[model samples]
Target: MNGHADVGPLTSLDLRLQWRAAATADLADWAALIARTAAVERPVWFERRADLEQILASKKNPAAANTILGFDPEGVARACGRITRNPEGEKAIGFGCVDPGWQGSGIGTGLLGWMEARTRQRFAADADAGADGGSGAAPRLRLHMEQQHTHQAALFGDAGNRIVRYFNEMHRPLQDGFPEAVLDGGLELVTFGPRLHEPVQLAHNEAFRDHWGSEPRNEEGWGFVVNDPLARPDLSAVVVERASGRVADYQLASHDAGSAESRGYAEGYTDLLGVQREFRGRGVAQALLADAMRRFAAAGMDKASLDVDSETPTGALALYAKMGYVAVSTSMVWDKDL
Candidate 1:
């Protein structure tokens, strides 16, 4: 019943399902719908029900206003869509999936139109209120989908959205020993601590400031990362400049039991990795990744994984390759000018 197996034009609208803004009460239904899609396209990446609950609670994507769900007569969610509002950013990012049984029914197309309109409205409201300094740039709608979802390519194409960038999911086995990485003479390595959360966030913003599509995360957006219920501080690593005690690089790691069980292998993930602009060329990233792999191995994980922009300006893809990671899957960004 996965709609992803076949894709069609958005001409037919399935009006049997009732559409409404998401609510906390719909968490179970929405998560089930998400799981169905993940199984068909991205089995290694599934969101646990609790994770969906936490997402519903996020201010930037609150269930009450920013998210929508389509429910059938039996009250089962059949389609879902939402936009992540980064007020300071020039793009509105969307995340959604249609129910497996309803892929070619035009529900996804209808959901996409709603999302595009919703994004335009948000931009207009912000411009009128002079929010985020009103940078005067034309707003864009961006969405991410795995390359394996050929049906999505058709749907997005029909909607006038085109591929913008490619990303790779790289993974290295922990069953084998990790490479030895030494910190630079002026830098020291340390585990992530609660006291360093905000510092790490600041360093992250400064590090990825120039990376494509990376916008500075305000307090709430940053909160979504540091406050993750399964964040592994012991597995996370930070690099500090010895002389000034400045955070030069950081790698945040976490693992979920549900995801591991679904994939049939345990993995420790580098959710975020960043190097301060001043320290990019000092092998800081290599050292941090090596350090992360060792931690994952020690923590009994079977592998270590992270995603990278294929055309990243920093040559991160080569570095990760040198570190023994191999690209296992690809996800792409699609953009439509509004």
Candidate 2:
């Protein structure tokens, strides 16, 4: 029997809600559903099975089950949701999507409600286990949606979620060429290598600590980055502090060949860019971006893309703008106390 067999039916449709924990076999179906939904909800975005696999493998809190699928009586995956708790269990990140055909039929809302309840239950268990014993407030629940999905945003709003953050999906045309990267006196640039993965991961966590909704990555999460088949280590760069010989900043890049082909242009993606707090103002970020652009150009890519918070403390959006990146799309983060 399906896990959600006992759940009530969706009011607007004849579909009975059936729940199940996602397994390795579900990757293809999940990717297919995401693609089908994105074709209408977010045409510019691409979802891949590898990415889904990585997400499933990188569950931060193993004891807190998060992946839940809502299926129809016919065993079709009509909706899915996942909630990932941070290490401290003080915050949980939630995301879900409904099959476009069933979107307005209330599957999305039902999935979200189920995810919220599951998250709360997990948080309560964590609290009882002394994981979040000291904090008096309930864990924060957050979800992200593309800004263009106004209807979905309205639904989330009606469900008591408020906008908390906005992110710009920025793109730069590499065919136009790029400026020379200037490194400060105390910093040295090095190509990404297997040896630098651990240090880079540590520096990334440190750098992103102050960012809103940021969470430190564990080994599994870090592995998802380094082990990804699309990662172009040769095109990526890391800046090391000459004095301390520590990773001060880094850029991890990837080449999405399918996406590039779909768009009729070769493109490189800047998957992650982070600079240590103490090294922020020393031109580290600009240098890293320039290096990535240069590499993309050399690789015959027509464009490079990355996403940044609009309200980033590091002025990342402005910096990307200065580097000739333009906003192609925007996504919003919705949050509520759970």
Candidate 3:
């Protein structure tokens, strides 16, 4: 796979802009460019430079190499995008943001095409290396857009991508006192700790196996999430089945001050919440969520936020609603078979 074309001039753009693969040195500018995109749409959440670093941590493709940036003559970033092909790659996920000024000038379309090609390139590299071609299903390139931004959805539609799924960003005010985690049967709730790291990762893979676009987390990728600087083990909890000492369910939570900057109150987030198939209807999730919410309140957070698949058969949306979480925003997942 030729990686050279990954970065260069953007002659396709209607405006004068240069496209180049990002480097560690460009993270600050890369993040600033995305913030500008969000600022134009809704300044509700912001990602700190560190967050981008954590997201782009990879052995196969370093943060700098896996990301691309579009800059104007002044050396200012006007667009940014990243590509991630998970180990169990049924899908290659593409994330992008364009400067509001450059939105209508073909930057979005150009960036999407670049990522799609990069996805193909990555998969070809894997096949060349004799890696298992992942489920032997047709490869797909996926992109997500906030539902409020119909224009972004239209962009994907114009690119031949189809709506594959929907997701909701839900928030819960830390009012109404937090509830103590209570599990029936032989289940016990405990704070996530060092010893449980790999176990939790393994459990997460099983727990989410049936969910849409879910991919098994390879050790390196799992480490990125488990060891994130913003991760709060104190706020995360796992439900264990005492008899077999198996992880019945888990809630992985984090606090990102940068994300809550626009809000009047501090926010803690449930980054991942999963329940083993056997434990789904037995209250494992409820207990973990309650435990996380309690910890968040104790940590002085004024609200809790989580993103959930709208079409999950696990009834997560209803449960979250039952627990007082309400949809604040929505995002749509679109995919184009590669």
Candidate 3 lDDT by residue in tens digits, 239-309 = 99999999989888888776566666788899999888888788888888888888899999998889999
Clashing pairs in 1: 1-100, 1-101, 2-100, 3-100, 3-103
lDDT for each residue of candidate 1 in 1-338, tens digit (9 for 90 to 100):
22221121122335777767767777878888998878777655766677777787887555655677777888788888877767767888887888888889888888888678777767776778787586865778998888878899899999999999999999999877888888769999999998898888889999888899898878888787887877889999999999998999999999886787668889999999999988988889989999999899888899899999999998888999999999999999999989
Name the lDDT of candidate 3.
0.79
lDDT per prediction? Answer: 0.82, 0.79, 0.79
lDDT of 2 by residue, 195-264 (tens): 9989999999999988876777778778878988688999899999899899999999999787665578
Deviation (Å) of 131 in candidate 2: 3.2
Top TM-score prediction, candidate number = 1
Q: Report the C-alpha displacement of residue 294, candidate 3, in angstroms.
A: 1.2
Off by over 4 Å in 3: 1-15, 43-46, 63-65, 134-136, 179-181
Give candidate 2 misplaced runs (Cα > 4 Å).
Answer: 4-15, 43-46, 59-64, 133-137
Give all TM-scores, in the order shown: 0.92, 0.89, 0.90
Sorted on TM-score, best first, the list reads 1, 3, 2
